[model samples]
Target chain A: MNPMIAAFLVLAGLTCASALAMAWTKNLLHAALAMFLCMLGLAGLYVMAYADVMAVAHLLIYVGGVLILILFGIMLTQNSRADQYETHNDLWTKQSGRFWALSISLSVFLGILFILNRSMSSFGMVSNEIQRSTKLTHVGLALLTEYSFAFELAGVFLLIALVGATYIAKHHE
Target chain B: MNDIPLSYFLIVSALLFSIGLSIMLLKRNMIFVLMGIELMLNAANLNLIAFSRQDDQIQGLVFSVFVLVIGVCEMSVALAIILQIYRHFKNIDLGAEKSRF
Candidate 1:
């Protein structure tokens, strides 16, 4: 009945519903929209979990960078027909048979729920203290001091990925 | 003054993971599949964040940051490859009989 649980439930609902929408829709653009909402809800959930830094980073990277890239991919790869002046791109995507997908995912979901239910008793022994403090300072210090090597490595990896993507996407005659 | 239980976060992550799996299995477009992969990655990241809340070392938080970086890298590379595939076959649909993979 508290506000925190209420917010969590609302955010989780938004996330799961949009994810289902993404799964149910055949239109690629609609799926993208659903993904956008899903990412938003996830960021909110991160904030609720007390990782505000991660929430912001997730917003910037996924919503700002990745979603734009996805849109560009959709634009460049559109199924252009003779109607060159058509405003709407062919956003509809073909789907595989639903029977197998639904059944498999359903079973997987049920299995995970069963496992979690069984494991819940063991988790009771774990510390219940929730760190409500801001993690920005700690995360920054850790990234620079303890995790410096990995941080630099990630920077290099990102640079390589960017360069490689552009190279592969370039027109080769 | 009570906080949300860890189990709630775990349940949400599980749901998200399964939805992502179904999306990966159901969608035919390369980009759609990529989106599904992103969802799955985020679900794992959520689990890490939730666990980090309870851990003294905060290892899960640090690890999740790396996971985020790796995910972005994967997305960029995959989209590039998808673009190349589209160029080669004039379509990005997987398992299409017209294109020999």
Candidate 2:
């Protein structure tokens, strides 16, 4: 058992477990906490894949930016109609049912696994070029040179989205 | 030069995507649904990064970066829309009550 595989197993376990916890819990806050753990585990998995840049960026964006946005959405939207307790804020949510959701997800996962198994040999095209160099250098240069247009487009799109979000969220009375 | 089999990553990615799909299907809260969508997006990005591991060009890595940016954009916009929906119906549950969406 190589240490790398061991670490990957641990991180994948953490990611999947927290994701399941998020799916199982009805409380909004608990789900948010579970999402936090899931994202952290995902960042770990990215690092294991030698995507240090993507891992750090993912950690920053999901943990710092998106999570805060989600928390704000939680706070701003609680109706307070079912005020079970003062401190709790009535964060419990509802689900349609367990049977369909569970069955559908299981089926989808198994189907994907079967397909991946069938197509396994096709992915071997990259087997011979297993470069272990840090991807940060290549990613940076490519984003600036070959992908400069797309890179700028992403920035502009982000600006537009933020502006549009603020406008949409404003009090429109 | 650690050589972790790619199948492990794919399996993990599949599991994450399935759990996220279940969450999206099961949860009624708009925020919970959004989180589920985020999870699915991350799972796809994981596949991209994993596939790019052995490639020298790192095309998947760059694509994943753009995906991350787009995911953030979607999150912000969706959260804002959810906020407005909350104001309209005074609740965020998609199917919890008489509301349908």
Candidate 3:
């Protein structure tokens, strides 16, 4: 196999393994750390796909910002007990019924694969021509010109949601 | 078979999406559920970036950027809400009998 394909497989494996670890672990902190690894792998995959801008943005947003947010959330919400080892609830159900979730997800994946296989014939196979060197200017222009309204709407929505969330979260004594 | 085919990306994305869904359904912790949601969002974003590789307009890439922003916003607000819930109920697990309406 080519080096690029090999790299892709390695990244894919890391992402999937971390995700499964996140699912399997009962410890919340361990799951969060696994998610961090998973996100890092995803950013590497984005870089491989020639979306360096997105990879950088994703790393910044998820690793730098959101992960910190999640950590703080965990800290603030957790019970203040230095001695309690069982912070996480025992949430495992019976083993026999657990397979249903995996089976359902597998069937959904197979369905998607079937659809993609049918549609693959129609899409022309285009070579991966290297695109522009930088996306910052193009993204800025598109945000201002073609997507200005939606951009503004997102800002407004975020503002409203922030205000609402703050209001709801405050102690109402 | 050859270079990384579009199908490879699609299948990986599909698996990610399914895993995310199963996590959402199976996990009892609210924070874990939120992580699942984030995973699902990223899976969709990956699909968009992969497809936008073929299009000259790069619309899918642009859309994915917006999706990223929205996901962050969602995460912040949801975590804040979870904190409040924990303060009131002393727990963050879903379907607790004490918190039932």
Candidate 4:
């Protein structure tokens, strides 16, 4: 096998394994850690796909920003008992049935696999062209020119969301 | 090294999506469910990037960037809502029996 394929396999393994760990673990903290690993693997995958800008942005946004936010959320929301100094929420609960969930997900995966297998042969074959090195420039131009309205709308939406989130999270009288 | 096939990416994405779905269903914690939603979104993003590799326009890559922004916005808003829920109920677990009549 070629090195690219090998690297892809490794990254894919890391992503899948960490995701499974996130599902398997009962401790909320462990799941968060597993999500960190999963996000790391996703960044690596982005690099493999030649989306260096995305990889870097993803790392910054997810690792630097969202993970910290999640940690803060965990800290703030954890169930604490007044009588005991220790603080840990009972994060796990017994579900009535695990088999149904697993089976449903497995079938969905298999269905997607089948569709992908059928569509793979139809993709036009072409030599891999040299990827444009000017990704950031091109993306910026496209966002401003072709998708200008969407870009402005996203900014507005983000501003609104931030305001609303802060209002909702504030201590209510 | 040979180029990675589209199928490889698709398969991986499918697996990730399925895992995310199962996690969303099985986990009791609201935060865990949110994380699962993130995973599912990322899986879709992976598919977009994979397809964009074959296209000259790079539309998928651009779309995925927007998707990323939306995902972050969703996360922040959802977590804030969860915090409010915790403040009100003193717990963040979903489907708890106390609220239901």
Best by TM-score: 1
Off by over 4 Å in 2: A81-85, B96-98
- Span of ten consecutive residues with least summed lDDT in model 1 chain B: B92-101
Interface RMSD of the candidates, in order = 0.9, 0.9, 2.9, 1.8
Q: Candidate 2 residues A1-173, lDDT tens each? A: 88998999999999999999998888898889999999999999999988899999999999999999999999898766655467754478888888999999999999999999999999776575666767788999999999999999999999999999999999899
Q: Candidate 3: TM-score?
A: 0.88
Q: Chain A TM-score per candidate? A: 0.96, 0.94, 0.82, 0.88
Candidate 2 local lDDT, residue A58: 96
Tell me the tens digit of each residue's lDDT in model 3 across A56-152: 9999999999999888887787765666676564334211235776788778878998998898877665544646355667777888899999889
Candidate 3 C-alpha lDDT tens digits along B1-101: 34466777887888889888778777777888899999999999999888776666778889998899899889989998898888888877777665551
Q: Answer with 3 or 4, whichever has the higher lDDT.
A: 4
Among the numbered candidates, top DockQ falls to: 2
lDDT tens readout by residue for model 2, B1-101: 46788999999999999999999999888899899999999999999999898877889999999999999999999999988888888877886564567
Candidate whose lDDT is highest: 1
Q: Once superposed on the true structure, which residue ranges of model 1 sit more than 4 Å away at CA?
A: none
Candidate 2 chain A lDDT trough over 10 residues, lowest sum: A81-90
* Lowest lDDT 10-residue stretch of candidate 3 chain A: A89-98
Q: Each prediction's TM-score against the native?
A: 0.97, 0.96, 0.88, 0.93
Candidate 1: residue B80 lDDT (0-100): 93
Give the CAPRI rating of model 3: medium
Under the 3 Å rule for N, CA and C atoms, how many clashes does model 3 have? Answer: 0
The digit string of per-residue lDDT tens for model 4 on A1-173 reads 78888999999999999999998888888888999999999999988887887889899999998888898998898777675665554455434258887899989999998887887767656425737464778778888999899889888888888898898888999
Instruction: Write the residue-wise lDDT of candidate 1 on B20-88 in tens digits.
Output: 999999988889999999999999999999988987677889999999999999999999998988898
